[model samples]
Target: MNVMSVRRAEASRRAGGDRHERTVWPFAALVAAAGLVMLGYALLAQPGWLTGLTLTVCGTNPTAPHAVLLAGVLLMLAWGMARGRQTAWALALCLLAWSAAAELEAALAPSPAAPWRLAPLGFAIIGLWHGRSRFRVPLNATRLKQAAEISAFSVTAILVVGGGGLFMERSHFETPVSAPDIGRTVVSMAAANPGPAAFDGPAWQINGIALLSGGLVIVVTGWLLASAPAPRPAGRAQRAIVRAMVSHPDSETLAPFAMRYDKSYVFSADGRAAVSYRVLAGMAVAGGDPVGARESWPGAVEEYCTLVERSGWRPAVLGAGPDARLLWEERGMRSIGIGDEVIVDTGAFTLHGRSMRNVRQAVHRTERAGLVTEVIPERQLDPGLAGQLRRIHREWLGAAGREHGFAMNLDAMARGVHPDALVAVAMAPEGYAVAFQRYFPAAHAGRNAALSLDVMPRTPLSPNGVNERLIVDMIDYARSHGYPRISLNFAAFRPLLARARSSPESLTGAERATIRAIGLLDPLIQVDSLYRFNDKFQPGWNPRAVYIGSWFDLPRFAVAAFGLEFALPYDRRRTGRAVTAGDPGFEPLKGPAPVEAHRAVRH
Candidate 1:
């Protein structure tokens, strides 16, 4: 007896496991069944078996089969709900209920019609209502109530259109029919005329128009609901905060954590000891409130100075105010030569005396090296040669450990431009390319034509003189094209061989102070070297000054704010020597000023 009981228990356990597996996805079987039913009906309709069977079972009542199908769908939805599939169940139940309602309306009516015509409209309504909860979640109670009211209006539109059409046709419209068998004809005709009977009365016409308009309104509303935008993903912090706020609206203080890390600063009304930096432009705050400020070139400079004073930190202002040198002198600051801005005329211009000699030497050497130089429109330039230019650029970048430089992408360049610019290259007689330069036309009126030079690596080249030849060739090309000026744009400074010499040494107290401030912030030795290299170009120099609201309120802050990264560093060696050299009062001299004049020298 005991052995028999154990065997029965084991069998029962296996049966229970099978039942659990079956319940895992109850909707799967329903979906398959529905698909099969639809396929069978479509296929058998050719032989008239499906339609004939449906009529035989329902006695020519079109709604009977629809009601049975809708009931089956509802049962499937209930099964899904009982199996703990919430999302699936919600969608299925809504669809099932809508389908059932539509089927019942069709089935119980005095006349019934084909089911396919009602299917699309029923499914569209089901989709609109399925995910309504998610949309209403973010909205307030009032908005939710308003949405509900709109939903009612939409339903009213559908019902008035569907029901009114039937009423008007039956009560006021006449049907033009010719048939043989009275009973059979009545059934067929009535089924076909499920909508309102043909209307002749004026009131029926008006009601018909109203129903048509209402149907349009419902269709439009359904389309809008179906086409609504998808919900956006929420960050953890935002999601948490939203949840907390919704749960506890009265909480005054929330967690201090934020999704992003951004530095911010505040300052007093007076711009003293505020904040400043070279790379980063400090955010402006006034009286513990964020300040609204514009971000233009001039506005940026103004804000930079203001923040410096407010921050109460000290640093150098390489090239500062006109009166800055005087302040530097008073504060015992220092300064040095940085670089020069080179400019060349594309129109009629001549190199005289020493300038002419330099140009002649570069041209003579380039020609003697068995090389040819010419300017060709970028499009006419050989594709292979352009590729060589890009390769050279890559080599230079690799040597410099720099990822980005003036390298052109071949595929991009191949897609040419109108009135394309020129590229000048010096090719050796042996077919090896020696040097190349790219010239661009002026972008706008009043802007000078420009070009960038990149000479081959370590090819017995003198950067200064070779660069001069490249510039001359560019200028000649521009002139031939009728451009007015060709700007060199950038160049390294060489103080020892400066084309235009600046005044030996002369600076005021304020200028010395500002220079010292800049030096303190950026103490890198390489900066001065770069300055000297730029000076060689003999370009006109202009002092790019740093302006502040007030120096007294936040002197140190201003220094730190506009320190090293944003502002250039002052060379103490240069500024000190200049200051000590017999303070010569400001004297306006004529003739082309020295390149150092543009070097941001202390006043």
Candidate 2:
């Protein structure tokens, strides 16, 4: 490779192979290496890095306690540098200068190579100063205070409990030890260096305390350095902006989903477009694509990435359509196809042909079972009726379930939550609302009304096919009135799953293994069951993909995506299969479905 190309390659690697991340020295890795160096000195009982210096400068492995504490601070600063935080830059300047001064004090004047020995460190200090403009993101005072308070509380508690305990039980030491000695030993243990403590025998209690203190320190670093600042909620002004942007007909089917209260929005420079996103596991995950003025999309995308970078977060998109996938690629992101959105043309759809037999039978069967359907704007619904639907929604999700929606589902069905959204209700023979499907209007002109399915839930006792029946009613209504453009449930890995279901023999063993693995999870995730339902609709499919800041993002992406979709690592600790709120849904790249996700046959 040529020199420039080689430099670029190395820079990319140093940047953790992600351009979206603000390139700072990888601080966590550096902290780890520093810990390793400390380990070397602790084990050898000599200062390895400082061994070249005169021995009079060193007293008993200075790397143990002091260096360990300094390493944590350095790690935090590295995080700041990655975030372009000004405070981190100022602190780093001081830290580097101190290290350089220490080196000078230790160096012998006669050694000519001493200058060379310090060149790399000198260059680093100079480079850091030269890059001052890169550090602009100031630490949020409130967040920093919280981190400091928590770390201080943890450390103080450990010292009081561990150090006091050790001092009280001085007999545990091999030799008689003073209170100050016990205090220093406890400090060393909190710094993850317990070996310096001279124990009389197998001191399990001290060791346990050391492990706890070390673990607390690790948590301290993560909380202070890597945790995202508390997410800013959309105020009246921003929510007004989002509502204004999403209400327009051409904002696309998924546009209204941007109004989900959980997400924070990023507006273009011109203030004409916005994208809604949430930060999870150090990633800013934009829900689908940006919405609003077409000309301003690039600005919105740039603004989103910039926001994420300023906070030291990796940028990602969860349900980007084909056009959006390309737009993200232009920003140097990599993407993989996650699923396809099923869009059915109302005028073309009919319960005819043998291929439509299953859905047709379902619709008829539900109708014969005394299911009745009604379509109306949520605005027209009675307050009592809305309460019933909400109840059913909760029951469908079960007791411990959360709505788990982002891209295509809203948390609740409150009025003005979704502008121009329609609700389709299916009632049982007994007269209660058995199930309901809320549809967000993509755009409505004259005879052309485009709708995308949003929230859907039904009671456990509801008969089979009430969902199919309700959907058919909406399709028939739209077809009779205007050019019906209806969107259905998103089918993830549809092609693969369909192939697995229809022709398993054609797949390689590895592919078969993957299919079988999903099948094993099918009882929990319900991937195959939903794919089967969408297939019968004979809808035209629009391919969709998920984008990540970089390949290194894949690991966290999986974890965050899981936590976001199923509340996996999140609170409530509810265990049952659960999908996010909607389908006939393309909260594309959605994870596990709630148990009975398909038993309810919701779309």
Candidate 3:
């Protein structure tokens, strides 16, 4: 579909009317204001002094209670109507009918205020009817579940209140209340104002009726929620669409991760572009920028944000590139630079320079340890060899007790290995592979110049240089294959961390505080160590960021990000099994590591 048509469809879906339709919102607002005014008048108006003196000086208006209730109901309906809720429109109509009856009652009592009270209610009803189409968004599985859950909660509250009321009423009686009497009172045909014995029976019976009714409601609601169909997944057609877009030359380092099975897709109205995100802790976090035409990205972001908000989830974009950042900011989102990404220029990279001495030394040490390296096309790897790699990965995860994902990580590395992808492995002297790293092919700015590091795993007992060896081999392989750039791991807080570590004595307050904060994260993440490891390659650092709309959501976004990344240690089984750190099914990509320099240099 064309962009214009898509937007129109979206508008129609949201408003259930022509996008250009004039809303009846003014009348709704007027109705709410009128109700508030009536309430205020009833609460603040005083009777004439002589009448007040004759009336016992209670200082209360007889109309206040009714006015307050009417105002509250009106305001709630107006609020919901403004948000285009069909339920609010239905309730408003019901309330207006009830108010009309009240108006007739007042007129029969010979009150002059009846017509005035009915006017705004009549207008409200008209406005609600006219704008009924505004509530166009249909209730999906998520919404159905939400409605059922709300019904169940209402039933619970009603039961609690009714039980309490019954207890209070029964307490007035000197005799103890019996369960049988309570049941009898609930379904009782007895008249009101009965004796104490009769009251006790009615109270318990009323309580019993409440419990039965509420209990039935709860059960029905629960069953509906349970039986609701599971939400639709991104099927083959959607994947094909994304896959086609993934080749469009502007995809970033995080692009590959967007295709992971756990994520859902939101497309631009044109269907030419899409954003991928997973819901974690009620946050709809996009893995990165939209995956199609640059022109359609804004539309994709807008659609993603709108859908997420309507679903009652906080929308955010994480690990977005500089281009993605601009689009997110244009949408009025606040962004924070989360970290730096290291990209190595393969064509210009060489190990002969003095700066390459550390990496070269690590390579030599690994060679001396009889470590051999090989680069294999992922699709051609043997199943037994893949199994061996999985064992190594799980062992590493067991000790690390953590696996991180979402944006830079791929799951089930061996299961969904892409045909064009490559895996670099380092074989220990013992003749078995000790470490391996997976690299994904990606395009940037319409050129196949980029290869991204996706997964890295090394046995804890493997030689220190094993990881270095795999990286070195991967870089050489990329360079030989004519790829101009290879993306390394992300280094969180790299700039401030590098400054703090290189010259601690000259630290500013910000840097000092940054170091302290990083120190606190040392147990959870090797922030400094990872920075140092990636530094060895002397790659250019590109800043990475996360964009959000509110400070209150900062913590929520953090928790959601961590959860999606699998940073938390959780045991999948409930047995007395020993706890392990990473996913038993898959391990996410590892972050960049700093290379150790061959010679020490002055800061």
Candidate 4:
């Protein structure tokens, strides 16, 4: 019966220990409290009292207070580890080994006076080891650098304090203690009073102080070297590769944004694929679909997602096409269809059908106003004319009150023209350029299949239908050049909302409510107007979506996506009185010095 009772007791204790290991918060709180106490003691404790307790007959022992300081540091490390900081876990392990060494020295004392202090720290180190799975994230370069810096600083502070205490002892004592005596006194708690004659020995014999310090530096440096490297911005070599891969046939309408300077790129090993993204507020936001060969997209996209996850940031793909949305959905992400991209088939585009009455009438009116249109490839445009166009662009931007756009607009056009770009200019009766549009190449599979409308800026004095005439001319030009398509502006939720409103009987209660909410936002966002304008072209609408991993990250992703597209406060100041709106989805602006109305252009 006695043996059975003992066995039951042992089992109960083992079970209790297991439960304790799982309960991290309670242990973490206790460790944190201990750390606070140690810090307070280190900061407020009388240095004279500390020196008095550890002093040998020869000099004060400086290493004694260090055990308390180290305990404090280790407690903090444990606290961080409990919160799932991998770097803290790594630092805790290093400190646990260090604390054990300190305790061993204390235990080696002739009298076991200070060894009793090791129990709390030992339990904490053990607790951390048992709960190691909680800290699964790898320590990144930023965390590694921070840990290394703190360790190096701590070691330096300890050396400084020990050296200062030694100088004071030497100044006060007639028989000053040698470095070897101080070392032996700290480790063994026995004063090595080898006399003043011992000081005449070699200077390098200052015991193992330098050796210990050097070893600590090496350990910290090695840990930092072993940490994962930080993610870098896209460089020139990456830009070149992106330019090449963007020529893939299946690239989406917004793929041209990849070539912009503001974004970063991640590529596959063979350089046949890439993901262009920008990081803001700890979110890696890819504006559109991966730009690469269809076969290579899965690898490049996975690489990008993994890179973002390892860097401890949220990954969000905004304005992704149907194919990209399906891919993200397959990866367990939820997608919300955001909008529709309008693609006009240049071969079939004609102002002949009854549905095209508005566009045709507008084009004819603009033509009657003697507004001559000229279509020229970007590289063939004269430098002086390009400069004037740039000025017009800046003026138009200033009037529109916009400074930057990420998803589908150019932040800078004055740099020079892209080789594959096409520019269409409308000249007024006086011959000065009044309206202009820019088209970027949308080539695929070794063929320039489509042209993406990028910029459309006209002077305030130009006629209203200048844009319609320009598009008509562009379609004629594309047909002549054998290019098949022209991708126009995106219209957010056009058909769904339109259908919901037009045929209210078909929609469920939730759909009606959603439609009503979207309808309310039309004035502010111009969703309805943009859709209606694009519809006049009778273009094929391709679906675009923004899929997110976590619902909670929606607000942050919104900020990152729009913040990149919208102008800052300083840019608002530069915008003057114009109220700039609509980006990624092109809409008209309302302001002083409003440019002549043209067909809505989208990047």
Judging by lDDT against the true structure, name the best candidate: 2
Candidate 1 deviant stretches above 4 angstroms: 1-340, 400-421, 444-464, 489-603
* Each prediction's whole-model lDDT (CA): 0.37, 0.69, 0.64, 0.64
lDDT of 3 at 78: 61
TM-score of 4: 0.63
**Per-residue lDDT over 485-511 for candidate 3, one digit per residue giving the tens place of the 0 to 100 score:** 888899998878887767888888877
TM-score of 2: 0.77
Better candidate number, 3 or 4, judged by TM-score: 3
Total backbone collisions for each predicted model: 67, 10, 14, 0
Runs in model 3 lying further than 4 Å from the true structure: 1-142, 145-198, 201-232, 399-403, 444-448, 502-511, 567-603
Cα distance off (Å), candidate 4, residue 597: 24
Please give, for residues 24-64, the per-residue lDDT of candidate 4 as tens digits.
Answer: 56545655654554444446653665444233210224242
Q: Which ten residues in a row have the lowest lDDT in candidate 4?
A: 588-597
* lDDT by residue (tens digit), candidate 1, 70-140: 33443343333333333334455455565566666777688965555345445544553453332221222
Q: How much is 446 displaced in model 3, in angstroms?
A: 5.2
Residue 591, candidate 3: alpha-carbon lDDT: 17
Clashes of 3: 14
TM-scores of the candidates in the order shown: 0.31, 0.77, 0.69, 0.63
Judge candidate 4 at residue 336 and give its lDDT: 76
Sort by lDDT, top down from the best: 2, 3, 4, 1
Candidate ranking (TM-score, best to worst): 2, 3, 4, 1
User: Which prediction has more favorable TM-score, 2 or 3?
Assistant: 2
